[model samples]
Target: STEALSLLEASGYDYTNIELGKEWFLLGGEESVTRVALSKEVESGATSLPKIFVGGQCIGGCSELASLIDNGELDALMKKAGATKKGEPKKNTGFLSFLNL
Candidate 1:
């Protein structure tokens, strides 16, 4: 669980509002949009752990996040997750750029 959270934080997630599951699995409220999206992924049988979702879509887990970051797609997802409004300029955080939210 410690490691799971560390990975989430390192990926720039704000872990405060999210509740951890019984075994420290990341969880959202029963009605959470992300939870629904992640559930779809699980139901579809994706063999990944630590699922990630944003803007009502399952973006995927740690490996997927790294790939998206490397490919520059993560910025858009961050924005969609309310990191910034459509007309807002991206915040300038030195090392952890996307964590500005």
Candidate 2:
């Protein structure tokens, strides 16, 4: 998970690390942002975990994510998401706002 986040970060995208299962509740009181649960069960036939939802759309799992990144789709998506240059306030959302997840 750290590696994944680091890769995204190195690529100039904003991300948050939510360690689920450590807490008793699923949402862990952070309800507004999207929650992506990564689990082996979802990787199986369950079709639920590792679900990527950008602007409320269900993008697929690891392979799909990799494809997007490799093909420069992820960078374009992040730019559309209003991710600004480092140290600059991201349009309307602040730095902390991006990390609030």
Candidate 3:
């Protein structure tokens, strides 16, 4: 989650809503909610935490996030995801805002 934290920090995102991702287990438990949902959202053999989502879309973790930022696509995605302007503050509606179940 270190890499994920760095990426989010650089992007000016607060990690409070997503800390649940790290304290998770796949087994039956309350901690699994965020992790389980994130795992399913990512269409791959495996999904890792600090899964980045914008506009209710799973954008992958730190590496994928860096890729988007490098090509300036990150800004585009943020805009499409209803990101606010500078000084306007971005409100994270959290995992429920993206996934139905």
Q: Best candidate per TM-score, number?
A: 3
TM-score of model number 1: 0.46
Task: Report model 2's TM-score to 2 decimal places.
Answer: 0.50
Alpha-carbon runs more than 4 Å astray in model 3: 13-16, 21-35, 89-101
Residue pairs whose backbone atoms clash in candidate 2: none
lDDT of 3 by residue, 41-83 (tens): 6778244455666766677766887898788786677766667
For model 3, the local distance difference test gives: 0.57
Instruction: Please provide, for model 1 over 1-101, each residue's C-alpha lDDT reduced to its tens digit, 9 standing for 90 to 100.
Output: 34444555565544332443443235445555544544565546453356555544555566666788679886777765665433446452221221110
Per-residue lDDT of 55 in model 2? 41
> Which candidate order results from sorting by TM-score in descending order?
3, 2, 1
Q: Give the per-residue lDDT digits (tens) of candidate 2, residues 1-101.
A: 44444545676644443343423235533351333333332334233334444443445544566788889788677666665656666463422111111
How many residue pairs clash per model? 0, 0, 0
Highest lDDT against the true fold, candidate: 3
> Candidate 1, which ten residues in sequence have the lowest lDDT sum?
92-101
Model 1, residue 85: distance off in Å is: 12
lDDT of each: 0.49, 0.47, 0.57
Each candidate's TM vs. the true structure? 0.46, 0.50, 0.63
Model 2 CA RMSD to the hidden true structure, in angstroms: 7.3
